[model samples]
Target: KLVVAVQGTRKQHVDTVGPKVDRQKKSPVCSYNEWDPLDEVIVGRPDNACVPSLTPEVKAISSPQQWEFFRKFGGQFFPQEHLKKAVSQIEEMCNVLRHEGVTVRRPDIVDWSKAYETPDFKSKGMYAAMPRDILIVIGEEIIEAPMAWRSRFFEYRAYRSLMKEYFQAGAKWTTAPKPLMSDELYDQNYPVESVEHRYKLSSEGRYVTTEFEPCFDAADFMRCGKDIFAQQSQVTNLFGIEWMARHLGPDYKIHLLQFKDPNAMHIDGTFNVVGPGLVIVNPARPCLQSEMFKKAGWKLVEAPKPMVPDDHPLWMTSKWLSMNVLMLDEQRVMVCKHETPTIKMFESLGIKAIPVDIRFANSIGGGFHCWTTDVRRRGVLESYF
Candidate 1:
């Protein structure tokens, strides 16, 4: 029961908050690891996708050269032609997933161009192009991350319809404590002067986000059955890691992995766990805790160099997204049609590669794995590490 005050006799006491969870039905949300046979997914939309303003948080992860794009087009839609190509590419990618016998669901198309003001801050919005950054599934639960970016604060609005349906179907839905993204949440002087300075700061575990409160993007974590690997990135802090560790309880082991990445935003592009005891690591962002994986008899393969050409506008992320392929099962993968070396690498490992072109989609941000958040994967919770 909820308590409400009757207002002026015009509005009666209304309880509009409670959502019922049927305990009898099995949850639609279920996934323990990345390699399980995918059953359902949530693909984000590029519609009304707006450029985030060049705030301090945005400044931390992006290169100085790319700052012009954000400055000129921030809080505005991306170039019309670019967004059109991206839409078509993603539609084809979704069809490919359906052909592979997986159910693909999409978030509601939101007008991210709308500007909003919070008590602590005022900002426009970013696109709902990357679902992997906001949603993560562990077993039967879906965790909504308390992300750091002020523009992305209301990003979860796009997924509420699906979240509600999943909840009614008995999935455990959890939204982390949203942080007050005031000036206190950022280190205004956090170094981004040059690549060398970034490298030094990252090595020392210094990031732009302060420990003022818990904040993280779901993409900062990589799920591998009982072992979940996470990184403290520019958008993810130590406080956020601690919050996840405590919230996940004893069923999961959150291993804080370190990498030598200057602009480490998401772990999937850097250290992706493809299968049981098999991980594809980015040679550019070497994992400092890789010796542990080696000691555990895990085969860590180096990803081939990305083939995304120079002058290709990658507004939000790095070219390492070529390595961010999604696993359909232990035997099949969704990869870039153009990345021949990546396809060859998978074929050599006996994993069949299903090629799809999303180069234009990659321009906005994200590849296969980054584009979709797996809702259900046929698997049970078991220890792997």
Candidate 2:
């Protein structure tokens, strides 16, 4: 049985769709939906499914040493309010899975309390898998690349925890090692060419996809982006991306996005084939041409446009990062609210679109799709006449 569990903000829902609300104000939350259609066919493990042995178990001990350890590590990265809310939701999601007979587990502070209590707690935060705490369909292993300062501390850790947990659940996981950049460029810290996204295996897992070459410089990024100070490299870093891809699965296909004429923001930003012959891409900024999508037996749909020119009032208000989508099937997808128009347009073509609420994180640059990666997908079974 396929299941999907969602975390929603319903009170905000009414305000977003209210007739009097500003289109721009409501735009960010417009696609929010509690029940997504993709769940009917593709299970959302992070939201529901659980693995038993992979679950974290805690025991109470009278020893002061143990008590001290628990007190120290029990809550590190999050403030009380945030931690409470996060834990509650995680528990609820787990319970839902338990009700459905799925084995599930959550990471705990039992073994690493001492490591977490230090000032370097932030570095050790990798163990916790903060904001994106749970790992699902991808298996018991966690995977990640470098991120910004604030995000690096806890979010990366959360990503790792999920990856580790996924591997524990019997799924393969992998990633590209951090590249060694020149010191002169180190202060700028922008990658000229690299894999921006990756895929881990799940169920008959066979292939992996990543962003193409012709690396972007500051000019390719938003004008307001800090990395705008650098230059782009023509040579592609296909090997680094290929390294991670091959480590995780068998066969590989590089879905290279054409540069020069832009359309999609990044690889994950658009060009998701949720179902065979059903593709979601930004007609303006695409990984490849519409012909590619059509040739792959995919039906194309334009993705949401990103608002840029950082200084603009609406810049932050508009959705720019297209990386926030999860594929439920080749035809069905779970997308962020900002992608509502894209979803509606897709449904117009007889494609089923399911929206997931992720407004808070949308402000942070990524949405639900960016937060999670599907490790497993149902294989296309060709029927004989």
Candidate 3:
């Protein structure tokens, strides 16, 4: 009787272990810092890019000279010839990444000319050519930013498929609460006509985006293991930073940094954390907390003058995009082909510079770092600051 009972129990235990279940579950989204050995990445697409309307928020980031372009082409497609060259350039970038043995993923080609009406405002869509501006991966969670610009509100749609795929493969997916984007969200009278006034406003901790709601671009945050640095820019507000701090919980520390930038929109272009304790800082926009970095024993390298000519049309960014580079690992960096000084600087630091010509793509906005978001890097979370 005892032998028969024991056999029956063993058989029941074996039956409970279903055949469809696997014991090992691996997550597809994992990255802790910028300089780890990259496993996978999401590269943005420049197809059907649109110029945002010359709203107060847009006016805050771009210079007075570029406002004419926005006013003329707002809610309209970018020049097809320029976009064609950009498309071709980005394709080569993907090819280079793939050749380097990194898995390259592209967002869906989206139509940025479509007009949509939200309850608070009506606007056209913007292209998904800057994934770093919309998505950030912390630990295992990939959070989508509630973009401040109305034209970029629907940019997440282009990356929804990739997000779903990662979720199915055991990755944490979270999207921040979208703002109403009502008139109250913006400070219409925010001064942007003069650089001196904007500088004064920036020094006074004021921006075009009000504290009425939480709004941010993912590019505002620079990750370095447990210590993540963020800046309050025209697109990032205090409310948004607080929300991120709370959302991240106690596992991570959010450090608020202030720069002397009058038109700061993304941290990557201004203060890029390239490695564990190395940073490439923009001399044009000095960080007020630079002493903190110096005390922490972090090496801060000032980027050289950009080689982009005066005639090069940078509609949405400064020539400082030359410093905005992507690190394949701690030993390898992807820089602009024409930026000889930057290439020499990287080589001096014992890093290989993989040069590629994306001047046309730069006209749209962003460099290698802004063009791609690292999805999975082979590294664990470790304190670097």
Candidate 4:
């Protein structure tokens, strides 16, 4: 048996909806530090074109064709100039971090032409999202999670190769079958099922099985780590939580938020989390159940609705990419351009926000969090002496 130390809430984050076979009303017990009310965003440095704040610590493989793919599929909305601005912003972030003491690591962009050479990388699409679990760095090694999609063969060999290069040891993947009926719920556009798939990946890969047909939807994405744990209790759900508790211990905390809902297209399409204690969520998408937000101690800043008419070309174009932001550190954030409200909010709070143009990357449905896995992150300080 794997002897991993895990902490945080045992309850699934989805439980706020209602109690069912998979979800329960169990009082969450957290050994980790409670989220503090985040009020101010402290800008550490000046906004210098030369000085760096947001940095590209890591990046996925890229190709010219990949860039075209983004333009055709995800970047359809923005003019060339807008797109350029986004790309430049990401570079600025990377420079800023390097300007500071932090080290920025970029993955050699993936070469899709010779993909088969890497046995572990199955062609999910031109943009293969970085697994969330594996990206989080723990000590010297990076933890990885991989999943399977219909007709897509599991690329165990490619995984092995990738892990060996970037990480100290090989990776451990998390995945499950496509549990939802349709990829979308109620004809909504954003990627709700994709978020649900994350839970499945974590549970099945960890050997948890509820045997209950899992459900998926857009709102499910925003469910925090605690909410997801609270809803899970069946063989698979419980097993998943227990494994994480044992393995992760008390250092890491999981949080999830949604940018769209039943009629929505993308959560990050217009919203994102740019830093700790701040989120750039679009009010048009619909508000999440307040309990989840309150418990996590996140402060929300509503973004303006999409400027493009609901049916315009730019309408909901960000769906192809995951629009939400990822926290590389306390000071820097990576965000999608459409999530401008979030970017501005972070800036107001003094947190530096770097907007990455993900039109090319979003076609397969991933944002900064889904695209890059943080192999190592600073551990939260232990509360007790």
Candidate closest to the true structure, highest TM-score: 1
> Per-residue error at 150 for model 1, in Å?
0.9
Candidate 2, residues 1-385, lDDT tens digits: the string is: 3233322322332323223323343111111111122221112222211111100111110112333433443434323343344445445433543453334433333222223232322223222322221222222223343222211223333244545544444444544343322121111222212222111110111112122211121111111001110111121133433443454354223233343221122243434434434445655443434675466455566665653334422111134444345544435554544556666765776656555444433432244444433333323222110
lDDT per residue as tens, model 1, 70-96? 999999999989999999999999999
lDDT (0 to 1) per candidate: 0.92, 0.32, 0.91, 0.35
- Worst lDDT run of 10 residues, candidate 3, spans 1-10
In angstroms, how far off is 163's CA in candidate 2?
A: 4.1
User: On TM-score, who's better, 1 or 3?
Assistant: 1
Return the lDDT, model 2, position 336.
47
Give each model a TM-score: 0.95, 0.46, 0.94, 0.46
Expressed as tens digits, the lDDT of each residue in 1-385 for candidate 4 is 3233322345444423322222232111111111221121111111111111111100011222234444353312234454354355445545654564435444333322222222322222122223431222333333332221211122223344445443222223333333332222111221223435433443333212232343211112222223221222111133333444445556544333332233232233344544444565556554445456657687767654432223322212234233355565557666666666557766777767766555433333345554443433444333221
The TM-score of predicted model 2 comes to: 0.46
C-alpha lDDT of candidate 2 relative to the true structure: 0.32
TM-score of 3: 0.94
Q: Where does candidate 4 stray beyond 4 Å?
A: 1-126, 129-141, 146-148, 151-162, 165-260, 263-276, 282-288, 295-297, 306-323, 336-340, 355-364, 381-385
Error of 2 at 98 (Å): 10
lDDT of 3: 0.91
On lDDT, the leading prediction is 1
